[model samples]
Target: MLIETTAWGKLEIDEDQIYHFSKGIPGFEDVTEFALIELEKSSFAQLQSTQHESISFLLTDPFNFYHEYEFDLPDTDAEELDIKDAVSVRSIVTIKEQLELSTINLLAPIILNPLNRKGKQVVLHKSSYLTKHPLWAGNSILDKGGE
Candidate 1:
């Protein structure tokens, strides 16, 4: 299918790329459909709303930036998405004017069930992660041996 996006203009996307968000993203509760487009040679992907051309999010695999990043997918969430085997996790990224100041929202990760094309932004209620973590903060920790 073809969709218009502010970032990429008109583009062709596959049916498998489209995901259905039952509860939608945090603030976009009404928009239930989005296409997950991966950026070549980059860890980032664009979650573009199929309905709204301008409504899109920059997402990245938190693990790419933070190797130690871990979370438990509540049983309820797993069942809701009908996740049987394949699952994709991505964090919303906020890019700043100063590239180094970019932050990623680790507290709430976008989870996708590839098999069913279902998605959700699951909030980690018991996690120590914050909504905005410096995009490159993990480098310092690794540089200091996780001190």
Candidate 2:
């Protein structure tokens, strides 16, 4: 199938690439359908909304940078998404003018049931994870900017 997007324009994709977010993101409740597309020459992926061209996000696997990153995996969420196996946990990333200044959201992770193409954003209620975690080890973890 082919879907038009603001980020990537029109492109061919498979049905499996489409992700359904029942409640959508925090501010995007009306836009649910989206497609996860890999970015070229980068580790990030685009979670592009199929309905709204302006509603999209860049995501990345939290473990890629923060190996010790984690949050409670509730059984209720698992049951809701029917996530039995092949779970894809990704975090939303905020890109900056400079690549190294980009930050990723660890407080809320996007969980996916790959088998059923179901997806949802799980916000950590107990953890101290911040919404804007640095994507790289910016200057000995002291500086507020890029790595």
Candidate 3:
């Protein structure tokens, strides 16, 4: 299928690669379907909405930046995605930029089913997590051999 995107321009996307977010993201309830487009050889990805060409989000694997990152989903969410094991899940963080400070929303991670291409953005109930966690903070930890 051919889709027009603001970031990647018009591109070909496999029908199977389209992910259906039944509940959509926090603010994008009406925008459900999306395609995860990798940005060349970079670690970043663009989650482009299939329904709306104007709606898109820059995402990245939270674990790559934050090794200690951990979150437990409610039973309802796990059941909704039909998650069987840990390997079936992929977590992504939404990126945000403000002047010199860039941030990622770690508190609400978008979980995807690699096998079926189903996805959902889940909000962590844990108080320890922050919505605007600095992605660069993990670099300092890695520099200190903290992993």
lDDT score of model 2? 0.85
Which candidate has the top score in TM-score? Answer: 1
Output candidate 1 Cα RMSD.
3.9
lDDT by residue for model 1 over 13-34, one digit each (tens)? 9999999999889999999999
**Could you tell me the TM-score of candidate 3?**
0.83
Model 2 per-residue lDDT tens digits across residues 1-147: 888877678878888889999999888888889999888888789998888777789999899999998777899999989987689999999888876667888999999988999999998888898787778864233254434
lDDT of 3 by residue, 38-123 (tens): 78898788889987888988888888778888767788898898777742333455443432245567777888877767899888
**Local error of candidate 1 at 41, Å?**
1.1
Q: Give the distance in Å from residue 22's predicted Cα in candidate 3 to where it truly belongs.
A: 0.7
Runs of candidate 1 with Cα error greater than 4 angstroms are 138-147
Which one wins by TM-score: 1 or 3? 1
TM-score for each candidate, following the candidate numbering: 0.91, 0.90, 0.83
Show where candidate 3 strays beyond 4 Å: 86-100, 138-147
Candidate of highest lDDT: 1
- Residue pairs whose backbone atoms clash in candidate 1: none
Question: In model 1, how many backbone clashes occur?
Answer: 0
RMSD of candidate 3 to the true fold?
A: 5.0
